[model samples]
Target: MTDTIEFASYIVERLKQTGVKQVFGVPGDYNLEFLDYIEKDPVLNWVGNANELNAAYAADGYARIKGGLAVLVTTFGVGELSALCGVAGSLSERLPVLHIVGAPSTRMQRSRALLHHTLNTPSSFTAFTDMSKQLSCSMALLNQVSPDTPNGYVDAFDETLRQCLTQCRPGYVELPMDAVRAVVSTRGLNVPLPDSHAAPSLEALRQLTPPGTPSPINKLYKDFGFFEPKPDEVTEHVVKIITRLYEGAQRPIVLVDACAARFGMGPIIRHLVEACGIRFFTTPMGKGILDEHHPLYGGCYAGRNSLQPVRDEVEASDFVLYVGSLKSDFNSGSFSVHIDDAHAVKLHSYTTQVGYAEFPTTDIRHVLPLLVGALEGVKSERPRVLGESLEQKMKQGRVATLVNRPEGTDIVHKWLWPRVGSWFHDNDIIVTETGTSSFGLLPVPLPSHASYNAQVLWGSIGWSVGATLGAALAAEEEPDKRRTVLFVGDGSLQLTVQEIGTMVRRGLHPYLFVLNNDGYEIERQIHGATAQYNNIQMYDHQLLLPFLAGKNPATPFESHVVRTQDELHALLLDDKFNVPDRIRLIEVVMPRGDAPEPLLLQARLTAEANSGH
Candidate 1:
C-alpha cells in the first residue's frame, strides 16, 4: 500500500506502534544505513550513548519506566560485548529489554575474515543468543537469507520479537547490514500483531490447591534451611487471623512488597485491600500493580523519612498488616520497628504465620487471591483515620526542616527529602540508591510509583542509579503523564556514574540528585574511623561531559553545588530548571558520620537473619 516500507523503516514503525518513544545505542559503520534512516524517522528517537554498557543501562531505565520492551542498539564486536553487564542485570531483575545489534553486511561476510571490528567467528553472536535463551527462554535470529520473500525477514523478526516480549520480557535480535534495506512482498506484512496471551484459566487456578504440601515444595523449603509449617493446615488458620484483625482494628493497613508483583497477585491483593477498606502502601520495590495514586493508597509508611503527611497517617493507624511483604530491613527501616512484637497480623503465601513464627512459605500468587476469596463472608469495619491532625503536624515539621538549610553546609538527609518531594507529582516515579541517600531520604510522601531499590535482602551499594534508570524505563510506559527521578549518594554514584553519560547521549532527561557527602559516610557511620579504607578517590563532580554526543551537541543541562539552606531555598523556588530539555544536578554536601535511621538498621538485621544470614 505504501510502496512497502523499508525493513528498517518498518522496524521504526512497529516499535513506535508499541509506544517506544526512543531506542538507546551507538551508531557504527555496519549499521550506518539503518542509523541514517532512523535519524530521519520522526516516530523513533535514536538515543546515542558513549558506551554500550550505559546505553543498555539507559535502555533498562527507559524500559522499567515505560513498562515495555526497550531497544538498545550497538555495533558488532566490542560495542555489542560491552552491553553484557546491563543485559545480565536486566535478566536478573526480570525487566524486558530488546538488544538489536548491527553486524557486518551479509555480502561482505565472506571477505571480512573477522575484520577489525568483527568477531573472529559468530561465537560472540552465539554467546549473546545463549544469554537470551537463559534469560527469557525465547530467541530470534535473522540475517537476510530469504531471497524468495525478502519481507519475510521483517515478518518473522516482528513475530519473534512479540513472543520474546510477552513471554520472557527480555529479548535479543541481531541484524546484518544488508538486511537493513531488505524489501519483501507486502501481501501479509501488514497483519496486525498478535494479542498478549490470555490470563490463566480459572480451572487451572482451582487445581492449584492441594491436599497437603507437595514434597518437592517441601524439599525446596528444607533445602533453604527454612522451617516449613503445615501450609495446607495453616491456610485456614491464617485467613481467620487476618479476618479477625480486620474486624478488630479501626484503622488497619496492609503493606505489600515486591512479592505481590513478582508472583502476580496484584489484582487479588487490591481486591482485598478495597473489600476490607484497609489502607494500602507498597514498598518502593513493589510500587506497581496497585496504583499508588488510588484513594485507598496510604503511601509508603516509613518512620522518619516517611513522607510528612504519610508518616502522620502511619503513626495514627493502630494496626499494620504485612501481606506478601517480607519483614526486611528496607521495609521495616532496618528492623527499627518490632514487627514480630507489633500487634499486626502477617499474611504471606500459605500460612498466616505470626511474626517470627515458623510458617510454610507459599507462592503468594496462588495464596493471596484464594485467601481473599475465602474471607468473603467475614465482614469488617472500614479502616478509619484515628487522628486527623497527626498528618498536619508532621507536614509542618517536615516543611520547616526542608525549607531552611544551615548556612555554608553540605545537604543533610532530612533537609533533602521535602524539597525533592516538592518537585514530584502524585504519579512521578522515584528510584533511590542505597548509600546515605537510601539511608537518609525516606520514601517520598506523594502517591506515585516509587521503588526503593537499595537492596533489602542485603545492603548492596551502587544499586540505585542503575536501578533508577531501570525503574524509570519501566514506569515510562504506564501513560503520558509520568516522569522518572533518581536520588543517588556520592559513593553509589561513583559505582555507576557512567550512566550519566548514557543518559545525556540517549536524550533521556531524568532529574538526578546526588548527595555529595565527600566520602563513604554511610560506611563511616556504621564502622566509624576504623573504616577509613572506605574512602574513594574523587573525580570532577560534573561527569556528564564525556558522554554528550551529536553533530551539534549542545550542553543544555545545569549542575549546581549547594552548601547552605538558602541556596536550596532559592533553587526550589525557581521553576525554570525543571524542564525536560535540561537536567538539573543538585549536589548537596552532607555531614559525615550520619547513619541511616536506626529503624533501617533493625530491619536490615532482621532481613539478613531471615534471608539465611
Candidate 2:
C-alpha cells in the first residue's frame, strides 16, 4: 500500500498548480488522516471555518477570486452534507468548485451499519451531487468510475466534477480512505489552468451573421467589403453612425460589464471610454478596470435601489455604448427602465445573431473599435452636458420624492439605502441579494468608484453571501482598494451566513450589513400576508455564533443589534465598529408591515393579469 501522505501531496500539489491557494473545511473522524496531512502541508492553507457550510462558501469565494479551480475539503457524512447549501449556490452561478471529500475506508463500503451523524446509512453524501449539478454550471470528480461501486459514488462524483470543469460549472469529488492511500505518482498528472481551452477562431467568428445581415463567416473573405471601394463599405457604414451620433448626441456614455474582461478587451475599453470623454459605470462584477474616481465615472449602473442621481445620468445620455454585455437582470436594473433617451449600440460575442429590440446596431465587439478607428479623422462635437443641467435637476427631484415620506419611526426603504450609499467610496464593491432590498429603491446612487453586483438575471436569494466573498477577494487583489461590502437582508443572509467564518479565516475583511428586518420581507410584501412557513426562526442578529463555534469553542463575536434609525446613525458615526475584528449588526427596527414596493406591484400585476386585465 502506498503512503497516504503521497496521495495527499499529489492532490494538494495539483490543486496548487491549478492556482488554488486556499481550501475551506472542518475536520471529522473519517477525514482525520487527510486533515492531519493538511496540517503538515505549508503550501496548502487549510481554513478552519465554524461549520462545513461556511467552509463550502469560502471555497466559492476563493474560487471566484482565483477564477478557475477552487478546492473545499470536508469529512464524510455530516461534514459533506452540511456544505450542500453553498455548493448549490456555486451551481446556480456556474462557478467551479472542486469539493474534495474524505470517505470511510473502502473495506467498510458494504458494511450495512449506521454511523455517527449519518442518516440510517453513510450513502447520503453522494446523493447530493444529483441536486447540486442541477443548480451549478456542472459537476464531476477527478477519479475514474467503476461498476459495482455502491451508492454510485463514481458516477455521482466523477460526472459532477467533469461537467463543472468542462462546462465552466461547479463540481464535487469524494476520495475514499483507501484511494487516499493508493499509489499515484504526480509526474504524469495534467493540472489545468485558467483559459486553457482555446477561444473561438477567426473562421468561427466570420461565420456569425449580424442581425438582419446575411454576411456569414464563409462570405466574409469573399466580399472585399472593406476593400478599395468608395466610402470603404465597413468604414462608411461605421462613419455614418458616428457622424449621426456626433451631430445629435449630448451626454454620451459607455457601459461595460464582466464580458469585456472575459474577452480581454481591457485596453480597447479604456481607449473607447477615454475617447468618448463620457461617463462610464460598470456593474459590480465589472469593477476595477475603470478607476471609479475619474470624472467620467458614473458609478455602478444597477442595484442602487432608487439612487436617482445615477439613474438620471444613465437615462439622460444621448448615446449609450455597450461593450461585451449580456444584459442580465443585475446589469439591467432588475429589468427596471432607464436610458430610454439614448441610442444603444451593444457589443458581444453573439451580437450578430439576434437583433436588439432597443438599439440601432448588434454585434459591436468588432464593430466598436472599427467605428472608433474610422472616426479617427472625424472631429468629436458631442455635447458636454445636455439640456441646461436638466439631468441634474431631474435627479434631485427624484431623490426628493424618495426621501419625502410622512413621519414615522418606521425606516423607509429609500431612506435606509442612502446610509449605505453615503458610506461608500469610489473603490467599494456592493454585493446585493435578489429581494426587495435590491429592487425597491429603483435608481441606485453609488460613489463614482462604487458598483453593484448581483445575479439579477437568476434572481437567486441566497447567492449574495457566497458572491460577496468572491467579490471581497476580487477587491483585495487591487492595491489599496476599498473593502467590498455586502448589503444582505436577514432572511437571505441566513441561507449562506456560514461563509462568514470562512471570510474571517481567510482574512477577508468585507463589512457585512445584515439588514435584520426579521423575515423574507420581499415575499411578504408581494403576498401582503406573512407566509409563516417561509419565515425562518430568528437567530442572534449581532453575534456570529456560527463562527465562534469550532471543535473547541472560541469567544462569541462582539455584535451590535440596532433596532432604530438613531442607533444606526450612532453606529455609522462611531469608528470602533468600522475597525477590523468587530462586527456590528444594525437591527433597524422596521415595521413588520415593511414590504418592497416592486414585489407588491408584481404580485398585483400577476393577479390582474390572471383576471385578464
Candidate 3:
C-alpha cells in the first residue's frame, strides 16, 4: 500500500527537499491554511513580511544568494497582485522564485461565487492566473481534491518546479483552499526531485567500456566524474570559428557580465581568466562576479564613462570575447559602446555568437569550459597594459584628498563611495540601490571574495531594503558569516522601508547606509534639476528605527545621523559601530545636486538620445 500525506504537507516537503529553509510572505485569510503547514513543518519557517511586495523582493534577494529557488506564499488575487511588481523584477533578472497563491476552493469557483479578494464578477476566477502567465515560466493550478487525481496534481507541480529550475525564472502555483488538506500519495517524496540535466556522457561511457575493461570512461565513471555534455555539431563549428579569431588576434580581452552570476558561471570564468592570463574587465552590472584583486583585473568598462585607460584597452582590442554579457543602455553608457560586431564573440546563457555566425542552444556554461580547455596550450601575445589597477590608484588616497575640505562640508559623491570602499572587508556582501549608489560603486575597489548585488537591469529603486533582509539571512547561513551592507537612497527607502522591521524581527544585523540626498538626485541629473516632483518628504531616519523595533524586540539596534564630513569620518572609525553585533543604520546627509560621475555622464547621454540629438 502507498503511504499518504496532506497535499499542503507534500508541498512543504518538496520545498524543503529543494533547500528552501524559510517561506516569506504575509498571512491572509485565503493562505492561512497553507501558512499553518509552513509554520508546523519542523524544517521550514514562515518569514512574515511587512507587505506582500517586500516579501516578494525578499524572495528575489534570497534566490540571488542561495543559488536556488526561493519560495513566497501569498493569498489569492489581492496579495498576489500586490506582489506582482517584485515578481516581474525577478522575471526580468532571470531569478527563480516560486510564487504560491492560496486560491479559493474549486466548489466556490464552480458556483461562480463573488469572493472578497476577487473582482466580484462571476467569471473573475482565472483573472489573476491569466495575468501571471506573462511573468511566469510555468504555472500549476491544483483545484482537484479527489484522491484518484493525485498523480495529475503531482505531475503538474513537478513540471512547474522543473521549468523554474531549468529556465531560472519565476513559476506560479495556485492551490485551492479545499485541497490544502486533501490526501495525496507520499510516494513521490521517496524519489529525489530531478535537480539538473542528466549527464549526457553516461550512455556513451557505458557503450565505449566493456564490462571487464579498465578504460578511461570507466575510471571517470567510477570516480563520479562529470563533464558538461558536448555541444552539437553546429555549436562545435561556431566554437572553431571563435578559436581561429581568438588565436589569430594580437590583443584579445575578456569582458565579463551579470549573466556569469545568473547562470553560475563565475568559477568557470575565473578559472579561464587565471589559466589564460588574459586581461579582463567587468561591466557595471557584472562588477563583483570576478576577483578584482587579481593583477590582470582592469577597472569597470562603461563606454565613454569608463576610465581612460580601461576604455582604450577595450576599444583597441583586435578581438573582444564577451562572456555572459548584457548590453543594456545603462550598462553600456547609453549605447555608447563602439566595438564592431565582426571583431566580437558574444556568449550568453543559451546562445553563442561569433562574428557573423550565431549558434542557438549553445549554452555558456557548456561552451566556456571547452573554450578554456582549447586555449590551454595557446598563449596570448598581448601585454597587460590596461593602465594602473584600481587598487594601486586607491592606495594614493584619491577620495581622502577630498576629505581635507572644511569640517562642515557635506559629503559629496566624489569622496563618499571610494571612502566606503576602504571600509569593506573580505567576504562582505554589498548591495547597492539603482540610483546614485549603483553608479557610485563602479569606481570603488572591492576586496577579494567580496560580492556585490544590484538590480541594474531591472532598475528597481526600493528593492535594496527588502533584498538586504533576505541577503543578510543568506550571509548568516554562510560558513564564514560575511557581513551584509546596504546602500540605498532616501527616496528609495521610503518605498519599502517597512522591511527594516522584518530584519529586526528575524535577528538579522546588517549595516544599512541611507544616502539622504534630499530627493531623487538620480532623476534630477537626467531630467529635472530643480523640479518639485523630484523631491520627497524627508523622515527623521534615526527616530524611525525605534518605531521599527517594536515592543520587546529580539535584538538591540542602533541608528545615527551624519550631516558633515567630520561626523561621517568619525562614525566610520568608531569601533563599536564598526563591529556589527546588532543592526546599525547610518543616515548620511548630502547636497541635492551631487551625483556619481558615471551617472552624470550617462544621464547627459540619455537626455541627448531622448531629444534625438
lDDT (Cα, tens digit) per residue for candidate 1, span 1-613 = 6767667777777777666777778787776787887789876767666567767666666665555567888877677777777776666554567777787765566464556674567663355455555554344567535646655677667756765454325676667788787775454446655322222332322233322345434565579998754544445565666566556666666777654543455677778866666677766455444755466776665444355566666666567766656555556554444333355655543334454443443334434666576555666555344232222344556433454554555455556665666666556666666565554544444444443344444344565565555555455445564566777777777767765655554455677777776677666654544565877776566644434333444436677777766687687677676555565577766676554453345344545556775
What lDDT is reached at residue 594 by model 2?
62
lDDT of each: 0.59, 0.57, 0.81
How well is each residue in 491-563 modelled by candidate 2, as lDDT tens digits? Answer: 8887777766556555566677777777888767545466676687787765574443344332224456666
lDDT of 3: 0.81
Candidate 3 structure quality by residue, lDDT tens digits, 1-613:
3587788888888898888887889988999988988888888878899999999999989888887788989999899998999999998878889999998888888888877988876558888998998899888977643546747677778768866766678999988988788778888777666342221232322333212334433344347875533345545666778888888888787899877787777888778777777778899988988889777787789898787767887899888889878788888988888787998999875567888866555666667777888775676676635455657655655322333443447788887886788788888989999999999989776887898999888887799999998888877767887889999999999999999998988988899999999999999999989899999999989887789998877789999888887788899998888787899999999988989888989899889889999
TM-score of each: 0.68, 0.68, 0.91
The model with the greatest TM-score is 3
**Per-residue error (Å), model 3, residue 549:** 0.5
Total colliding residue pairs, candidate 1: 38
Q: Which 10 consecutive positions of candidate 3 have the poorest summed lDDT?
A: 196-205
Highest-lDDT candidate: 3
Q: How many angstroms is residue 535 displaced in model 2 relative to the true structure, after the best TM-score fit?
A: 4.5
